[model samples]
Target: MIEQLGPPTLFFTLSSANTKWPDLHKLFPKTQSNTVHHNRMQFIENLVNNPHITTLYLHLRFQIFRDEVIVKQLHATDHWYRYEWQHRGSAHIHGFLWLPQAPNIDNLDSSNHESIQSVKNLFDQYITTWNPRTEVDHLNKQYIPAISNPCLSNTGVISRSEPCTDYTELVNVVQCHMKCLEYTCLKKNSTLKCRYKAHWPEQHDSSLTLDHNNNPSYKPARNDSRLNVHNPMMLAIWRANVDCQAICSKKAILQYISKYVSKTEHKSESYIDILKRIVGLINSEDTILLAYHRFMMGIVADRDISTQETCHMLLKLPLISCTRQFVNLNVGKKIFQL
Candidate 1:
């Protein structure tokens, strides 16, 4: 809680299969099933029991924490969020918000032109790199940011007569590598062309600068590698790899969303990947992608051990101050038929 609910003025990431879920073509409709691995395991179990994709994923997680049109459209005062299921089993949402009259980074006064135009009007009203000339802005054209530069992969034991360094001391740093040449190079070689290189040519348009932890964020334009964005309704209900940002401090967005909210289980494989997944020798689409990544990592580790035993029995219970307003705790408006 960033030392008891303080830092975090917007930071976002929400994903759960994109193309705005039509529930696997409306509950497995296109199937001419020849046991195409049991029609892709009944189309991933009817796209995970889709009741309109769990009612638009619980109405976009309760309109991003109780909507008054998204709390006056992101003027949001307080929020903290976590939900991860990934490993291709979708549902990834890491949010943090706390505007509190935005811009007060230790009293920012960068040669005060009204405090740098109030931090460039809070990064032009909460981030944009420019990509939606409105076709009803269909979610900023799925976050444009293209890339074919995966450390320029030709991974057949390096041999490209060397010569490809120029990272220029990691320009705006955010580096991670490994996984060579699937659709072409992101890593695996000694050189570098683009994980985020080729001289930063991808952010589409939205620049205020300073953030590689120096704070004062917002920088979006990039074309040659493609990264222009301006979130069309959070990429139309969190489809694209939406990563809205603003927070520069609060210990760097609390060590970046607490490394995706207590991330662990990098891997586990006891009986040699479970006897190659119980003698079937895997490959039924990699055993339905390893049983949809171990059934959403065992339902997110049993909902984090039942939310830490209901926060240790509500810290040995003893406080109840009910005013007049009862009900509506908003369990995402409770519609769970499936």
Candidate 2:
């Protein structure tokens, strides 16, 4: 990845449950035929086999480009990304985008006060965890809060799973739902609070943190604890769990991304052979020399997509193909035209 794209400037994750990809939610919809979804293995197999998940992943790839142009207005020069069929019945993606113009310690000829300010402005303008203050934003569902994770109340009673009663109170006090969820875990572990120290009463304060790795990471301030870090346009489109963060230390991020890349996968012998050939090609002297030349010349990386037999089966299904139109909200909106 470093050979193709310089260092990454942004790292983000997109999940299937948080996506608007067509036919994803209907893969095992509660119908007469699919009522026996309690079979965990079958359910996961179905999720892994669903082509809509891949379609969503492809759409999200484009959406990232769209976001760079329309929202951030910055050039996303190059990116390296990967996907995973999560065990919890959804598709997960991790993308590392290298924006040459981003102002940070990673970039050369930058990291000055003005450059830091510019980066900070971009962070503030793009990354936020607050409810929509405008009517347009509300109508667009711009400030979608994550479902409050269950927690123990102040009275030593377990928090309710059904209709939330003290939701407002807990949110007002804890600042973040994750913080609330950690209360019992902390007690069980005999710890004072969350190890990350993120559970404290929320503070809307921006910090220029220089860690042990000498990486300057930016954290934008937000007054409200209920909001998750996300862009309005991003949430509006994906509407699922979305995380956008500035890349601090390139080495640190490289290590983090490597973990995902090295994840063990269930594959056929043919798939394994294909991977081995690709690795050989990548390690070849000619390929390495050519890539180095391209890297030196500042050429960018490209994208690739492929499907397996499972995905092909789903794609070829008549019932699945017939329901593609139901996957998009915009398509549903225009249904009155009929």
Candidate 3:
């Protein structure tokens, strides 16, 4: 596909927050006799017991996103995506989109300022790191009354006239996009460093520049360096954290994404040794049923399966989806035409 179509225009990740979604919370029955704390616990319990609900919700939301954003807004000519489960059992999608009109990084001339600026303009059109909190701060400096979360209402109604409605939605729902120090980012190297490089340098203006490796990199004008780049409208509609990045280096980005999408189940060295021993114990004289049982035991040992993942598989949901049909060509075989 890469040989035929070149690299994808954008590489993105969309994450799901099952607990944070009000729609998912509402799925549980409300009881007058239950206290607020009790109701919250019950709701969590329901989610744990019925993992399929959240899995299905994630699938449905992704479908809506594909139709509304990918097809309508971006007009992606080709795309591919895969779903993966997080440690906490939440589902997330990693995808690549090919936009026919997007500028090809491979063809970009770094020496030409006009060309670089044009590419930056196109990137800024779809992705941004602007936070609405800056606007609130500006208003407060001018002695305007402080605005609160617009979605927080007992009646569950937001006035369209409310000035902070959009701001509140972006800040509240996309909270996860904010970078913070965690185990995942903390690398245990000689000198500990953040794997995500969360401390992005503040840029006064958006610019398309070359990185240390001479790979084209687009840095959007950012007041809050901690906030990840995202599409504002898409973030609002999805009501979750999302990351959008330009494919600066075709080979690098493809290799990175391919590693993630093709990753196998993680197995420790000790587990591998055990599996090898189990295989060794199975002799040719052994019955097929006995050998199969031994092999299954070895494979199952130390394998962790989250409830959500189990539900995802049991429900027969697709883990991968692509817009274009692919055909396999055997380069090793000789073709003879009669």
Top model number, lDDT: 3
Per-residue alpha-carbon lDDT of candidate 1 for residues 111-212, written as tens digits (9 for 90 to 100): 677776666677566665443233443334232222222222222312332322212111111121222332234443685445533234444345565655
Rank candidates, lDDT, best first: 3, 2, 1
| CA lDDT, candidate 3, residue 182 | 31
List runs of model 2 lying over 4 Å from the truth. 1-5, 18-75, 107-112, 133-197, 261-338
RMSD, each candidate, Å? 20.3, 18.6, 11.1
True lDDT of residue 52, candidate 3 = 81
Candidate 3 per-residue lDDT, tens place, 1-338, comes to: 56678778778889876655655655555523322232445666767777788788788879988989888888888888988876435678988888877877778899988888888888888887665665556333222223333222222343344536554455544543344433246676787678778767767788887788878877888766566788776666676778888777786776876787697775433656766766666667878787666655555433466678888889999989898787888898779767
Error of 2 at 36 (Å): 21
Model 2 vs. true fold: TM: 0.49
TM-score-wise, the better of 2 and 3 is 3
Query: Which structure is stronger by lDDT: 2 or 3?
Result: 3
How many clashes does each candidate structure show, in the order listed? 13, 2, 0
Candidate 2 structure quality by residue, lDDT tens digits, 1-338: 55444556667766544222223334434324422323334444554455465455445454564566433654566655555544322345666666655654456233467666776776676675554344453343223334232121211232232223333222322223344332123433555564444532455566556666666767767655445555444544443456677665667686786786696654333434444434443434556665444343221111122243235345552211110133435654555754
What are the lDDT figures for the candidates, one per model? 0.45, 0.47, 0.68
TM-score of 1: 0.26
